[model samples]
Target: MINPLGRLLDENNYIVSDGAMATELEKRGVDTNSALWSAEALIKNPEAVIAVHRSYFEAGAAIATTDSYQATPQAFVEAGFTKAQGAQFITQSVQLAQAARDEYLANLPREERLAKGGALLIAGSVGPYGAYLADGSEYRGDYTLTDAQYRDFHRERMQLLADAGVDLFAFETMPNAAEVKALCGLLTDEFPGMTAWLSFSVGASSTALCDGTPLDAVATMANDCDQITAVGINCTAEENVTATLHTLTPLTAKPIIVYPNNGDIYNPIDKSWQANPNARSFAALAPEWRAAGASIIGGCCRSTPADIAGMATALAAQN
Candidate 1:
């Protein structure tokens, strides 16, 4: 079989899947918010990461992301590790995904495979520089970093993924177009052969990104970036996606990928994120998104393996 992700984009069609959240997964054992847990968990429980990846693939995900989103120097500080110590964690994240892919492919039926055989694509996920601000405030006023500084930090982590043979580098959940543009240029300049996938969080109806850049502007940046293969949204409101999708389809020629959060904003008081839209929602919407020109479909926050399985069934039926 052709690469599932490559085929999905090549045909300008939607292929359903799920994106795993390391925060939520780590929460099961250690309070996800705790500092020591991240360091300990990164070393002690590669299985947990592997388990999540296996679950997504078994549930029918065409792609699985590495657990490297939180492997930054600042995150290491929060996790009780020195900046220098983060390298091992970053390398391990890639290794964890590779293990999951190997195990998944091995378990496939020994016979009846296609001529090209099954190849699972591993996407290395990179998130915002800082953890979601505790209060979700804008980073502009409180802190500012030169483009070079930002590139330096991101490049260190990107190199780990590239060296470990990641199938793609996903700049995911970015709230600003400028950040994405800089990171894209930095990566493309460094790793010219690797595929880049850019995803934004739409804060509202009018903005391409949460920071309020025009949707066309995001499209233009994604297009101009040498290695960008796809662009779309993740971590936006479900209600926000419909209009955003409509707006995005006409402005950009690239394949659109959508993975809105399953639950709305988390309410710290009750510690619950409500409005559970399951796989059925994904099943129902995948076609509409495809009709609107989305080439990939998946889940973001609060999405589990079952959600991906549901999407897979939906995609198979539609195809």
Candidate 2:
């Protein structure tokens, strides 16, 4: 099967992905303070979830990532859902995104829709096991699990997403090398015909992953995996992006995807975001990030539709 994302990049040079789902949901008056984070909207306010995805597409995003980042069975069970119910919710996440994509396209004129790039794709978001913890361990990468354990935790959701018809998988915000390896292996061994992008959660230093693994080391591992179509960083500070891209560009022939946070620091303790005086706008940084070699660009935590619009405008100016 032809990879639509690859085709789009071949035609357009860069692909614009959507911004943070959780951030958008919060703006829609949904409560996301629970362990499920944005997944809470899946159960409580699914229409709101659809609205968020549509807003991003309207803002010029060519890809819409699902709200399944924290929708794992373990998390749902801990939050008082049965495993089967959790599975349904995971499937629902994909459907919600598809609904948004369909609705967005229906209103657009046929010519405008065709001109909006290629088909708008839905990336099934497979967040790290740390996201299941909901305690900020994703940033620290302080957890450990055997390869079997990691695959077991992820398999059900991957299957659900595939069955629900996602365009690709997004193994995003990953911090642990072992888990990354497990996921890559699982994708190859089980989910044939699927493609994915692996984006890391890096620490303050751009040279290292959140787990302290050298960026070059993990990036090289991902680049070697045939099933992974792109490799780079996400949910990290915007300041770390260009440097992280510089480290990654030489390591992989795959496209580099970077969607850093909105230049804000997250206090995982209170689960609140604090503004950084030094944070720059995505419009201002888009040219620099593109110049540094990112072929897929968007926003992460605390990023809004406006931020994506700015990045899209900035990238459009490049051609």
Candidate 3:
């Protein structure tokens, strides 16, 4: 299959990715209080998942990231689901995104569809093992696993995503270098036809990953991998994004993709998000991130379709 993302980047300097999935679902009245998070919608309210994806598309996003970030087989098993049921839910995540993309494009005017690149891509969200822990380990990167073990944990979900027909993978919020290396190996060796963009979750310092590995080192590691189509940061603070992009641009020629949180700090203990007074709007920050070398920009946690609309407008002004 042709790489639609690469082609879109070739035609346009920037692409707008979708905003937060779970938070958007919450706005639609889905309960995400459990560890399953947005994946819970797959079983109880699948239409709501489609609505969130369509909302991003209507907000000017060209990529619809699937709601499979925390929908791993292990997570389902822990929730008392059979392994087969876990796989079904994972596949349903992609199907839901596809439904939204197809429905949105079909109803759009021909001129508008052409203006938006004529095609919307689905990125299967492959969040880190830390996300499955649901204890904020994704931000801490406190866990360790052998490369083989890491591969075992990720393989089933990735295969499900691929078989379900995602255009690419979004390895977002990755914090561990060992796990990333394992993923790269898995892609090259097992899924050579597939491609993905690896985005990291960094600490406040912004120069290193949450695992304490230097950003340049891990960025270089991912850049060296042929299957990694883009490299940058996501689910990080807005303040750290520009500096992190500056850190990454000089290291790799690959496209830089960034989708930061809406500047709300997460309290892992109580599982709540508190407002950050300093958080700036995406309308004001999107241009700066583009200037800093981000080719793809959007929001992460706490970011809504309104925020993505701001980014789309801000980025359009660049031309």
lDDT of each: 0.68, 0.91, 0.91
> What are the clash counts of all predictions, listed in order?
0, 0, 0
What is residue 43's positional error in candidate 2, in angstroms?
A: 0.3
lDDT of 1 by residue, 1-319 (tens): 1134666556534555556454447555744454322334566677777877877877777677777765665667665777767777887888887787777767878662242144457888787664334333222213346777768868888888888878888788777666777788897678777787788866766355667678888788888875787888876655567788888878777778888766556553334566654433666666666676677888887766776777678777778
lDDT pick, better of 1 and 3? 3
Poorly placed runs, candidate 3 (over 4 Å): 114-118
Q: Model 1 segments beyond 4 Å from truth?
A: 1-8, 23-30, 35-40, 112-118, 132-143, 267-272, 275-280
On lDDT, who's better, 1 or 2? 2
Candidate 2's C-alpha runs over 4 A off are: 115-118
Q: List the residue pairs that clash in candidate 3.
A: none
Question: Poorest 10 consecutive residues of model 3 by lDDT?
Answer: 112-121
Q: Candidate 1, residue 175: CA error in Å?
A: 0.7
- Cα lDDT tens digits for candidate 3, 1-319: 3566688898889999999999988888999998998899998899999999999999999999999999999999999999999999999999999999888988889897676545688999999999999999999888999999999999999999999999999998999988889999998889989999999989897788899998888877798888899898998889889888888889898999999999999887778989999889999999999999999898999999999998999899886
Candidate 2, 1-319: lDDT as tens digits: 4576788897888988999989889888999998999999999999999999999999999999999999998899999999899999999999999999989988999898777635699999999999999899899899999999999999999999999999999999999988998999999899988989999999888788888998778877787778799898999999998888888888888899999999989998789988899899999998898899999999999999999998899889886
Between 1 and 2, whose TM-score is larger?
2
